[model samples]
Target: MLKKDSLLKGTIILAAAALVVRFLGLFQRIPLDYMLGSIGQAAFNSANTIYLLLLTIATGGIPLSISKMISTRYALGRPDEAKRIYQAALMFGAVTGLLLATAMFVLAPVYERLSRVPDSAVSLQAIAPALLLFPIIAMMRGYFQGRQIMAAGGISQIMEQILRLIGGIGLAFIVLGLGWGDKYGAAAVAFGSVLGSIGAFSVMMWFARKLKKQDRDEESAIATDKAAKPSSKLPFRTIYREIFRTSIAAVVTAMTVQFVYFFDQSFFMRLTSVFYNHDTAIKVLAEYTNRAMGIAGIPPILAIALGASIIPVISSAYALKNMEEVQRQSSLVMRIVFFTGVPVALLLTVASYSVTGLLFKSPSGYDTVALLTAGAIFQITMMISNSILYGLNKPKQPMYHTFIGLGLKVVCSLALAPFLGVYGLIIGSSICFIVITLLNVRTINKEINLNILGNKWFAYLAAIAVPALAGWGTEYLVLNLTDAWANKVSYFIAAAVTSVIVGGLYLIMLAALRVITPEDVRSFPGPLRKVLTLVLKPFYKRAA
Candidate 1:
């Protein structure tokens, strides 16, 4: 069993590592975006999406299944049975990984033609080999997680991402330098995934060997103990059934956003064709993926990571039919996600163009970027609510809600396209997640009456709005007074100054509005609590 404090600490360690990996990912993405400009980027991203989908299919459910089965066996004091389960899972991973890798390699051209991108075929094939080892690595990571060794999984992830960045960008740059076109360069970058998987596999192997020895030692001591009884054998067939059962449910519940974005990638070019020639359509698609979607994707991922850390408590409470505890956990999670999400969504929406300039070299789809970033709050809500639903054992409900939202999303995009252009797609994205969030919330209320904000919801809205308006006005003045958009350097300056101003004001609002009380601060991790305490002390004293 995990130590009492280990759960929260482990969650924080994993979440922090996940965030760090995401931050490091930006280095690879930014360079790749510049190297493969509008058209090249569109093609590469399409291939990348396919890769992600396949990856989701290959590894998403299996890891959790492994973790669950292993934890159950070990909890029953069955080390030998746990070892058998791990061995069985490893065999499954090996077989599944081989099949998925072959499928990706063989289907590259079919997907390329469907998506209508030339280099996508090559990119798909380039990244196909990554699936071979990744599923196994995922299994190992899950085993360690089940064993309560969170650092192993975290370390492996960081190692994977770092190697991926180095190999992907470095190879792409070298390819471009060798006078290969961007098309092939994109393929080189795609192959970096293979290197990343190898690096992750290496790290996991070391941990697995160490853990295997520990398991053997424990088993030997048990065998020699007079009081110990021999462990009962678990049938591999029964274990496989259990694994598949959990795996299917997990995959179905987890695919909400990935499907939504897949719809975007599928329909984006066709939608843009209503207003642009072929080349321009490709350019707009590039900007939509790399700028709008790219920047907007960060907040929700991080928010979900944070919100999801408390979920085991929800699961535990719900399993015991403790509705009161369930409500408390759900409401607290939603509030924490909401509080953190507001500032990020606000900042990104207010300075979308400046951020585009600062990060992506220039603002291509200014409205689209702003609208999409604003939509991130909805995305964050959707992600957290879906997770909550899962904890409540309503996995199928989120999947059903997701499909309904996606159907409406398609209709919304078609209806709004004439007036909104790419912003229509952005709005459609928001609407998809919004509808899902609302439906999820409704179901959650029916199940547990989740009142996240009580009567203070309005105050929360005000907290978000005041700072956003202030930030907007500040950016407007900066834009008009100085030609920030005319140069990237000036845009960076404007964004930096505006961020500081908005951040300061938002902190003050947090105190004045009593948004971040000492009680709320105390709930956080020790390091974060200390920093937040120091930063908000003067404000608290002023309020007192």
Candidate 2:
């Protein structure tokens, strides 16, 4: 039902929105880290991790399921069936979200006790209601995505992040000023999540209503006289059955990353408590997971944005049995993943201390941050590959791989964290992601000749190394030259200069190495591609 140009345009809109949301998320965490301190942050992280896990279970798979099912039916010219499926998904989301929210509220205290974070139940309870609302928002977004109209979903996401930023930061200040304890302050911050969800749900509902009106207007314009046949509408029970069947695999595959984090939340403190006091362990984790990895999480958003756009695009392509288009999209997606992911990961590694200090006001845990940043290369790969598998209708493959990866994460975390502390956790995560990425890539290769990690891979490696090495040299020189100028402000300035130098050089390297071709730039959003065209004209000429 979606034209090619519209699909590409929608993907670009969503990807751009995703980038903005990631930036807003980073801004939100800055104030949160400053206000909550280590122990308070540890408590918030504990509750938030559980909240994320439950949220994933309640809302994650259903959207993908809705998108896939609706895309398929719509491609077959079955608008009535697609609409019926949307209705079923909405009802399902409402019931499921309510049950999950109630369950989360009831179990909040138990989770706090298990994690040994004091007063975390307050935050957990505060975030529960959002679970009931997010499912509805996700379902509506899925409907729009199924229609390949991604701007609605994109704008709704931006609205959520903007509101959450304002509400969380403001509430944190108010709570602290009012002499509330850190727990209540954390809870107030958690309440911002609820507020943000409400905003998102409202925006999505508006879009859904507009879409409905458009559909009705179009139907009226056509002026069909025949009464709609009952047979045209799918049976509700049958739709539900199919949805559940697809949703099982989708839920498991989608929850892979969240489940890894959930495992850490469940066991990290207990394991660290073995080596140190409970409070001390939580403090250390606050630095490692909460702060360091928090910044490290940004690069993967590029992959996540691409993956979200890829699922429906690839699904529709595969649905039509258009192998050529499928292959073309798959190749483009993988190239973008590697070309962007590698340099960003390496840049973070090279400037970990500077960036971490600038962002979190502390230069500690650079090694942990570097290791995690390195691991994100594989994380990005795994994310995009899994989406490709899901798009190709092989969702169970990713589910099985996720199980293997989860098992590895638990085993490695328990085995390593006891001895090496936070570093152990970092190592375990890296190994888990690497193994998962390999497995997913292997399966994808068998399905289609992706030619991934061949030929141009060495060029990708060179492109990553040159700028990263130069950036590191520049930072070392600057730091050594200005040894007396060592403060957060200084680090911030150094980071800004180094980022511009590193980023500019990396782009040049990509141009020189032909890792980013003119054809590739053409695939980008119109404005971005045009800017790149002007900047890289010589490189295009050289490649030609």
Candidate 3:
């Protein structure tokens, strides 16, 4: 059995690995935007949206349940049974993945027709082969995660992304430079997913070998204990039933948010195409959507990493009947997410043009991208809270919240798109997020028996908002003083520096007002505090 401390250490390592992967995503998008341009990006993003939806159906909730079941079984000293369960899951995943892939591949033309995207059929065709490969990859990822060897899974993610980053951009540029149309460029990018999946699978295979050796050693120990009692086998039927029972709920809960997004995209595509010419509107909407989504994508990656780590820790706390720890950690996670997200939303709102120019050099997407970036703050808050609810084993609550939000999004998209276009769609989505987040917060408080909306919540809101306004103000002053910087890199640097300065001022003011306790600061990991102290040392000394 793994000690609590050991599990915590593993979680930290996994979080670090996730952070690296997130950073890679940020950098990868830079090159992708450059190579794909706005139109190419639209095709790639559309393909990805479809791919993720399929992936959710293929492996989504099953992996989480697999991990939980395997970990619990292993903790109870049932290693052989756990291994058998892993093998069964692998087989199930393979069959499901292939069937889904085949169906999607065959229906690619149908989707293209429905989306009314003339050249996107080719891109969909190119992405078809990956469906066959990704299931096997996802199964291996789940197997490792079940064994609590999260590092291996994390490494596989990094390897997959690295390959995608290099292969997607490199191939797209080469194809486009060689006179290929945007369809070919999009196809080239789709092909990269296949290579990346293969690379990830290869790395996972090596990790599996190491696991095999460990299992061998474990088997020997089990043999020695066999004489003391007759070993019981969990029948394959029972195992399969158990796996499905646990996995389905997880899958639905995990995929709820993605499913909502997919539905929104499908609606957006159809609505926009209907209101405008097929080619002209699709092209414009695609660019607008990608730019908005690209800016919004950054913060979620971080939230996912943090939230994934938080889940198991929160789960273990619940398992151990440690309600205090559960409440503390949940609140802390919310506060941290709020602190990070609010300032980012404000910065993006204030400097949307600067950010868009710096990141993608596409001035056309500024308005919608700004709206989307602001929406991201609420989106991430909802995500974090929902994950916490999942960790608490109230998966259905999240589903309810998501359904409500999705309804709002669909209604707003349909009602607003005819007149408001992308901006209206964005506003509708943001409003939905805000509503969902508030509802989830209320549900979580009731479930956990904690007051989540008291002084702490109010203080964190003030802390974030005050600093965000200061940052916005500083940005305005700097831009006016320096003639808007003009250069992308220079503007990015100035905006980033200004945000930091303003955030610092906010933190100091909060500290002085005793909004956050010193113990709260002390609760952070030593290294994190050390870095914070280093950043704030000069100011502290001057105050002294």
Candidate 4:
């Protein structure tokens, strides 16, 4: 069994790697936006939305389930059985990926028709081939993740993004500069996805081979008694069945959020097209979706990193039937999420226009971006709660909560879209997340018989709200003060400066109020705390 310290260390390393990849993602999107422009970006985003939905279905839940199965097997000291389980999972994932990819690839025309955009047919066709590559990449990802070698997963993700960035931007510029139509430029961008998937798959396979060799060497050194070793030749069919059974719950649970997105996109498209001219409606929807994808997606990337790490640790603890440890870890994860999520969400919301302009040069998406930033509070809360629910072996509860949110989103979006357009989608999503978060919280309270929403809840709000307000005020001041030089770059710089100042001041305020305890501060990963200290030293020194 891995020690707590070892697990914590692993979590920190994985989180760092995830953060790097997310940061790289931000840089990559900038060039992609230039390549695709507004309409093309929209087309690409739509295709990716479909791909993400399938991805969630294909491999989302498998990692969690595989992690649980492998960890449990390891804890029980059956390495060979664990290896068999891993192989079975890989085989199953491969087949699932291929089937899903094929279906989606073939259904591109159907989706184009449903989307109701003039050139969506061509764009969708351009993106259809990517479906063939996505599932294979996802299967490889799930396999390595199950082995708890997240470094491989992290490296593969970075490599994929790098290839996409280089190939997409390069081809996009070439096509556009060569006087090719937008469709061709978009197609070139989409082609990058194929290259990225191949790079990811290659890296993962290499890592898997190395890991397999290492495992073999370790096993050879051990004294093998018949009692100590399980049967090496388990039936592949039995192994496949076991993996499929274990993975189904995870797949459903993982796809919940994506399902929400699918519902939103479908209804949003229908409502907008019905209420307005098709071209105008498509442009509006494209703008909003791009904004959400660009800005709102960032926090989840970060949250997922931390939340993913929590799953295996919490699952193992629960498997040992240690309720105290489960509660402790769950609480820690939620608190850390709040501590980071609150400030980031607030900053994003406050500086939404500045960020949107700086990142994508698309001012039309600012309002939706702001809404999504605010909505992230609920998103992060729901994510942490859902992770805890799953970790505690209560998968159905999360699924139920997610569906409730999904239903609410559909109804709310339809009711509000005519009047509010993209903002309606944002409002609906926020309301859905709030409802789901509350539901999950209530469920946890009932199960554990603990009032989680006591004084600490208020403290979380204070920790987030105070900094957000200060940051907003400071940013507003800076923007007005620098009006003479308020170009995009200047505005972005001012916003960044204000964000840092406000965030620092907010941390100091939290410290003064003791909202975050000394123990809480200490529990942060050492490197992170060091960075935080460096950022806040001036303020703390003043206070001291």
| Root-mean-square deviation (CA) per prediction | 2.9, 3.4, 3.4, 3.7
Kindly list the per-residue Cα lDDT of model 2 for residues 1-544, writing each as its tens digit. 3222376677778888889988887777777777887767776777777877877887777776788788889899788899899988889889888998999899999988887777878888988898898888888888887887788888899999888889877988899999987888888877888889989988888877777888888778885645654436678899989878878887887787778777776777777766767767767777765766577778898897789778888889989989888888888788777766777887888888888777875777677788888888888888899999988989889889888988898899999888887777778877888887888889887867785445777887787888888888887776666667757767776777778878888888888887777778898656657878898897668767
lDDT of 3 by residue, 1-544 (tens): 3212256666776677776776666565666666665466666666777887888877877776677778778889777778777787777767876787778778878887776555666667677677776777777766677676777777787888889878877888899999987878987887777778888888988888877877777677765756664554667688778867776656665665566557656666677655666566665666565666767776676677667778877888988989999998888787666545566676676667667767775556677777788888888888788788878987777777777887898888788887776766777788778887888889888857543335666666676667667776776666666665557656676567676766676667555555545455565557656665665555455555
lDDT of 1 by residue, 285-384 (tens): 7777767777877787666576557568888999999999898878877877776676787888888878887787666676778888888889889888
Give the higher-TM-score candidate: 1 or 4: 1
TM-score, cand. 1 vs. native: 0.92
TM-score of 3: 0.88
What is the C-alpha lDDT profile of model 4 across 421-482, one tens digit per residue? Answer: 77787788899889989998888766564323347666666766677677777777877777
Strongest candidate by TM-score: 1
Candidate 2 residue pairs in clash (backbone atoms < 3 Å): none
| Candidate with maximal lDDT | 2
* Candidate 3, residue 207: lDDT: 82
Query: Which of 2 and 4 is ahead in lDDT?
Result: 2
Model 4 quality (TM-score): 0.87
Model 1 spans > 4 angstroms off:
1-5, 225-233, 414-419, 480-486, 514-544
Candidate 4 residue runs with Cα over 4 Å from true position: 1-6, 71-87, 212-233, 274-276, 316-322, 449-453, 456-470, 523-544
Provide the global lDDT of candidate 2 against the true structure. 0.80
lDDT of 2 at 373: 86
TM-score of each: 0.92, 0.89, 0.88, 0.87
